[model samples]
Target: MTTDASQSQAHTSAKHLYQRHQSVLPDWLAVYYADPIELTHGEGRHVWDAEGNKYLDFFGGILTTMTAHALPEVTKAVSEQAGRIIHSSTLYLNRPMVDLAERIAKLSGIPDARVFFTTSGTEANDTALLLATAYRRSNQILAMRNSYHGRSFSAVGITGNKGWSPTSLSPLQTLYVHGGVRTRGPYAELDDTAFIAACVADLEDLLGHVRSPAALIAEPIQGVGGFTAPPDGLYAAFREVLQERGILWIADEVQTGWGRTGDNFWGWQAHGQNGPPDILTFAKGIGNGMSIGGVVARAEIMNCLDSNSISTFGGTQITMAAGLANLTYLLEHDLQGNARRVGGLLIERLRAIAAQLPGVREVRGRGLMIGIELVKPGTDEADPDGAAAVLEAAREEGLLIGKGGGHNTSVLRLAPPLSLTVAEAEEGAAILERALRSTQF
Candidate 1:
């Protein structure tokens, strides 16, 4: 096929931009592909690259685009709010902020819940750490193995993943806990009952040795750790123990919030028997690409701070308007129900394909969030090269995907928009199957 001149020019522009990007940006920013293609625009679940190639977007900008690309409602809300006023700090009364906060408090399921908005998940979690340590008067914290909280210093101290954690210098003392990743840890070989018992016992033992921790922070499903998760009710069991010790529980729902998991609105609901978390941090999907993040907690914990604080950019008018509109559309459409139905079918289709692929060590996830772990044929050793090859091959087939894991980073991550259609799921799976086949031994 002969390419159009305009498309050819676009490709050249992309190359030129990439060179400028590399020269100016940090080296660790990490981009996909050997020859990276700049995405110019998107609509719904598809995006067009610089070379006029349209690809099915499965990652959704790391699951930030929860609803869809270029959603008219959100666009309209943002435009209207921007035209009126963009930045009015938290020093004064913000009606849009109050309205959105009220909606989130009721939906949060925490009794007498209070909300504090932030600009990103990192800030939300950082605020939580501040609340917990101040309330408990201890800098010690408990975190699960193979988990990622955020990028801030306090966030990194609690982050269990070495890949994402950039430094060991931190003000807080962190104790790594078990039960985050069930299949790869020492408790992996045990049955569900035994595994839960073992992890709880380890937690108790760990607590006996250290000072009382301010909180136990964890992600229900390790998002950046390759979509891995412990068995259902694992955190519930941990909660029982922590409750006895007066330790608070913090649920970081950054990637798992807003009905992405299908079965539960928040990822922590899968382990809700112990009651809602003492503090919950959320971002990413809630804003649907707008920069909105926050923490919800009971008034007791949220009001414990004696000193005053405020976020200069948090809970601004425009982002709040976008959140209100996006949340309204999401609830009206019952995207959670759609995620359950469509995700169920998509997982089945991927499982069927994985059965025929030797490199696919495991296919795991819930709802719209799914992952495919790659290995060296029959061996259990991770095959990161195979993952990269499959990623490139899928791009060639006009499909976009992502990669994540613990030690070796060998799992293909898939978290498309929650409103993805069944036809789109089928198409993505077919392209992935071809990509996987190309990586065969």
Candidate 2:
């Protein structure tokens, strides 16, 4: 559909450059082979390749840059803060750390939720596990099925995916609840609020059998698990159960937090206005692509930590400054509302297309987070070969897309930043359609 001569030249040049000069990509990154079009810089929702060709980026660096790319305010804050203080030991107090803590606490309804900063989401989840184990003195962790916490041992132990890596297997400390409480032919919806109530009921039954549980970990939307938004009343149900059992409610908002899902700063708000988690961990989007993570835990748990304990370099001045600036723009510009409006429009458009297209199965998620399931000519689950072809074709067409289903079952996930436009959404979907149509599947 791109008829402009300059655009064609740019894409062709990049392709040739990759073919002629670029080294073979590393094996670790081989799991997700990026498009041959290597990027150089970006502005707003669009990114440019080495050849100066622009692509509307719907992926948003895996939903890390929530406000947009090259944000003037955020960049200025980072520059100013870095010039002043790059890194400092945790032995002293920092201004940005204190302010970010206050901001996070005010947004999270928990009155005394204490913040602990880390360098990654994995670390936050890992620390949350350690805290839970210590608090309850229990070994068992109750993780929802299809949940993705992190790659750490404790997190990988709880993750439902078995073959994530060869060494991913661990002593089974996790349990998988059926994706949705209701059973449909192939896929289904979570029947209103009943799904959460059912999940709670199931948990109660399981707890009656188990000796004890330390923590229950889950995401607001199972990001890697087809972006399935947890059912309504789900958080409150989990909260009540954990409160009664004196267990930890750990909400892994690494992917769903920071207003990606709209109407709130965190995904727990998806359930209700002020629903708060006992221990909430955030990483992605906190530093706008910088590797910074932290947890906002209830004071009940924080109080358990000794005064001298829980000190780390996770909340340095530079990272906190970037995070604060990123969040300020998101809040002040009302980007969360943009995510809701644009994402809703995208859902409607894609759903309309799916109504007529072969292999089109489901459209689900919130904000700019989306998952479009691709099946075979007639199949209940995924057709892996077909899915692979779709991805391959999209890559060849100069667009970048990611597949996010835990079991190698296929789904093309769209988690663009909050600033994606209706035109870009349509173009992306059209490219997907063209790929599917061209492939052998």
Candidate 3:
């Protein structure tokens, strides 16, 4: 068949699929692009659409593909484990699960750590909340403003981003705190040290007004909040106050964990003044795309529950095998170092490009997790339309990126695989430059 004819057929197939998807799927479920393309296969840092068009994947399936697409190590582990057994549940003795748990417990940094595996980050965060509330015996919780934990009902209760939080009803009384975003808040104009002080003071004041909170949950680097974060030591400062009042600190590392931040193996390490967080929840990227989520806490906090709880599919043999292999590959290759080196270059390139564009509000992030916030050319108003235009333009330029923010969704997110090469970074940056310029009206 001719290439043109084949492409037309593929496009038609995708259109039909879209129609079916619209008919059956929830209306609130969102998809990118005006005409969405069905991704067929992926390798390294690129994916091919059903229409056979290849593109550099900058978002890495919402930053879940930590290593790379179709990694041989993860693929082999999943295949071999599948041949033996897929799942035996948490009831039976699972060697792979125990092995991965031991490794994560040691690497987690919490003293006498205990790990509880879950199926997704939402579940992991939910587990953390349960532990914290049970341990402290308080339903009140503290969470950062513009932070996103997960999509589950319990997780949504703690989420500060109104866009992601569909319902106001929640099991926990979550108090949203300030100081997550450094660029656009009351503390935006302050220096790093002063900003930390102000946020700490705010926390102290908030605590005075509320009941004793169980825990303070935060994303060291707010992922869905446009990759925004407070000053490095801000959380550490809050820890001092929370510790005084016996409040636990839970770091949501679903998007920022496993060395994605480059400089630190875990995002919480960036604010490691008072040792590790009391509870740490991780998912995304640990299994290198496998469904793996877990919460790591000290033995005392983790053992607070009296009733028995077991995840039937949380630490399944296949997922554990995949997690073990993926973690080994990540460490052996020093992909953290790779992220530091390559992501540095990519951010610099994007920043340089942003310098010439008036609509580009700010480019902020660390390591591979970067965000380009868009705004009106001459004003500070968020340009959600401009962001959408740039996203479509980049897709046309053979690049796949992501969009995120608090409520406006005006920030362009770029988080390529940690194994991304310098050449690929440069190529993606070039495409982004053109895409950004295309929307400069």
Candidate 4:
């Protein structure tokens, strides 16, 4: 077939698939680009569409592909474990599950840590909430403004991001606090020191007005909230107050865990003054695209529940094997260090490009997780349309990226696999520079 003929056929195939998707899927389930591409397979940091078009994948399936696409070790482990058995439920003694849990527990930094696996980040956060409320005997909870934990009913309640939270009704009484996003809130004008003090004072005042809350849940770096984060040590200051009230601190590391932030193994480690959080929830990346979510907490908090609970599919042998292998690759190769080095170069490149664009409001985040906020040129107002145009332009340039924010989805989120090479970073950044230029107001 001629090249043009093949391209036409691919377009038709994608159109047909999109029509079918629209007919069956929920309306709220959004897909990228005006014309969505069906990804058939991926290797390393690149993915091929069903149309045979190749693009550098900078988002890494929302940062779940921690190491790289189709990593050999993980593939082998999953294949071998599947050949033996897929699942035996939590009722059985699952060796892979136990092994991963042991490794995570030791690395969790929580004293006498215990790990419980779930299927997704949402489930992991749900479990943490369960433990917190049960142990503290209070349903009131403290959460940072513009935060996102997960999509479950309980998780939604605690989610401060209006874009993600669908309903106001919740099982727990969640009090939204300040200081999650350092660039947009009332404290935005304050310096790092004053910002921390203002946010801490606000927390103290909020606590005085309400009953003692079960726990204060926050992401070290707000993921779905456009990768925004408070100044380092802000959480540590809050910890001191929460500690005085015997309130537990839960770090939701769904997007910030496993060294994605580069400088620290866990996001909370950036604020290590209070030791570790009482409970920590993680998912995405540990299994390198496999469904593996878990919560790690001190033994006392993990064991507070009186009733027995088991996640039937959470720690299946196959998924656990994948997680173990993926994690092994991540640690053995020091992918975290790679993220620190490569991501540093990438961010600096982005900032230099952004300086030339008036619409680019801010370039922020750490390690591999980064966000570029778009706004109206010479104005502080968010420019969602500008962000959308850049996203489409990047796609046209053979690059795949993501967009996210709290009220307006105007922040471009870039979190490639930790194993991303410097060459790939440069290539993606070059494409992104052109994309940003294309979208200039």
Candidate 5:
């Protein structure tokens, strides 16, 4: 068939598929772009659309594709595990599960850490909530403003992002706290030291008013809230306050774990004056897209539950195998170091490009997890339309990026695979530069 004819056929097929998807899928399910491309497959840091158009995938399937797409180590482990057995209930001893849990516990930094696997970050966080509430004997919880934990009932209850949380009614009593987003909010004007102090004071006041709260849950870097983060030591300061009250500190490392931030293995370490959080929940990139989630906590808190509990699909042999392989590859290759070097170069390049663009508001974040917030030219107002235009334009330029933010979703989120190379970084930055240029009004 002629190229034109083939293009027409591809468009028709995509349209038909989209219509079918809309007919069946929930209306609230958000898809990227005006014309969403169906990704057929991916390798390394790139993916191809159904129409055979290839793009550098910067979002990495929302950062779930950690080390790389179709990583050979992970794929081989998954295949090998499937050959033996895909799953065995928690009723039986699972070697892979035990192995992964051992590694995570030592790495967790929590005293006498114990790990419990779950199927998704939402489930992992839900489990953390259960543990904290049961241990503390209170349903009142503290969360950061503009934070997003997950979509489940318990997770959403603690989520402070209005854009993602659908309902106000929740099983847990959640109090939204300050210091999540550093660029905006009442504390934004303060210096880092003052900001930390202000947030700590807010927590202290909130704690005094409320009955014994279960725990304080926070994302080291607010992922869905546009890669925003508080001052480095904010959490450590809060840890001091919470320790006094005996409230647990839960680090939601769903997006910030596995050395993505470069300087720290865990995001909480950026604020590491305090020992470690009482609990830590992680998912997205652990299995490198193989579906693994978990929470790590001190044995005392984790063992608080009286009833027997098991996530039917959590810690299945196949997923555990994948996690083991993925973690090994990441460590062996020192992909965290790569993320540091390449991501630093990429962020500097983006900042230089942003300096020349009037609509570019700010360039922020550490390592591979970066956010470029766009705004109205010569003003502080967020420009969500400009962000949308840039996302669409980036796709046209054969570069796939992501959009997010608490303020109207105007921040361009970039989290490529940890294994992204220097050449890929330059290429993706050039494409992004052109995309940002296209958004200039």
Candidate 6:
């Protein structure tokens, strides 16, 4: 019997029955579900929903599609890897796992890097957290306030948003440091030295009296918090502080890693002055749509955790193959160059849009990772309604966007596939421009 119903009443009944499957879902799982045009498939810089609605994908699944969607290279690699061998236990020591691990470590410029793979960014971040705590044997972790590490219990406890309010998530022993204004920083036009000094001061104050901590975890660029990238020396200064305190610095590159930023192979590379992070975590683009993420820790850190370490399915052959293919695609295509070139175009266009849109306050972010903060006239630049309206309208206009930030729906994030071209960038911008131009108050 056909499930498709012809009459409206029949259609309603069918839909209700389909939705009934969701009735059994846990409330916690449902909490994170934001309904949208159900995406059916994607190719290049676009996707179509089940309803046959086509969309220009500007934000690459929140910067995860570093190579864009359905690229021949990534697809071919994954396909071949799948054919060769899929899921062998990590204990078996597959070629894919070993190869990808070696590649990422070399690219990371970290010495003697070892890998602990996970299935999602959150899991990788959790591994980073656990490794940090074990390595230092200290309970406390210092992450920036308004910084999003991940969503699991351990990562969420340190997340500073849900954790800071109402009650204390004390068992985690996570500490927070304020990064900056979180939205608008008047420090914009200030000299780099001045900004670095201010950031250093803020960190110092936050770090005061905390005897010692395991790690200082941070997104080199605050992706969820509006792609906030500090001055040149900020990371360097922060690292100096952490090192002086004997605290490991974990770079949560889940958003900014893997050439998502124009200038570097990893977001951490952009802060070359700062040097390498002791621990690095990655996910999102590694397998394209396939789930894979991992942690890269220095030898010392990995060694510290080895005694008590255990996780099943941490780095299976299937994910390793997918990750290897993803890495191969990046290295071969010079995708980082595309990110730098097209990202500059996209950012410039967003800035241009900001110039025209009364509600747009600032257009900022690194590489393909871009954000537009919406503020109406006479309101604080931190105002957010305009951003929300833009996202909703953009979706209606067949363009996908992501919204995030600490307190307001002010930030419109664009982490489009690294595969986006200059022309595609312009087209996506046109859609956004139309969305902004047509949005109601």
Ranking of predictions according to lDDT: 4, 3, 1, 5, 6, 2
lDDT of 6 by residue, 1-441 (tens): 233433444545545644764787654442112333446689888987655557888766667776868877777777887787777666676777788888888887888888877888899988888778887788798877777777777877777555223345645687777553434454555577877777778778877866688888888788677777676557778888777878888888888777878788787765557579999999988887778888998888877855555556767777776677777788788888898899898899878777866677778876788877777665655566667677778887778888776657577888888878888889888888888888742
lDDT, candidate 1, 1-441, per-residue tens: 327988788878888988999999999889999989888789999988878899999999999999998899999999999999998999989999999999999988899999999999999999999999999999999999999989999998888889899999998999999999978979999999899999999999999999899999999999999999999999999999999999999999999999999999999999999999999999998778999999999999999999988889999999999999999999999999999999999999999999987788899999999999999998899999999999999999999999999858899999999889999999999999989997673
Q: lDDT score, residue 295, model 3?
A: 97
lDDT, residue 43, model 4: 96
TM-score of predicted structure 1: 0.98
TM-score comparison, 2 vs 3, better candidate: 3
Question: Candidate 3: where is the Cα deviation over 4 Å?
Answer: none
Models, CA RMSD each: 1.2, 3.8, 1.0, 1.0, 1.2, 3.4
Superior candidate under lDDT, 1 versus 6 = 1
- Model 4 C-alpha lDDT per residue in residues 105-219, reported as the tens digit of each score: 9999999999999999999999999999999999999999999999999999999989999999999999999999998878899999999999999999999999899999999
lDDT of each: 0.93, 0.75, 0.94, 0.94, 0.92, 0.75
- Candidate 4 regions with alpha-carbon error over 4 angstroms: none
CA lDDT, candidate 5, residue 331 = 94
Q: What TM-score goes with each of the models?
A: 0.98, 0.88, 0.99, 0.99, 0.98, 0.90
Candidate 2 segments exceeding 4 Å error: 1-26, 34-37, 163-172, 179-190, 272-275, 307-312, 396-398
In candidate 6, the residue pairs with backbone N, CA or C atoms under 3 Å apart (3 or more residues apart, or in different chains) clash, namely 59-415, 60-415, 60-416
lDDT by residue for model 3 over 1-441, one digit each (tens)? 239999999999999999999999999888999999999889999999999999999998899988999999999999999999999899999999999999999998999999999999999999999999999999999999999999999999899999999999999998989999998978888999888888989999999998899999999999998999888888899999999999999999999999999999999999998999999999999988899999999999999999999999999999999999999999999999999999999999999999999989899999999999999999889989899999999999999999999849999999999999999999999999999887773
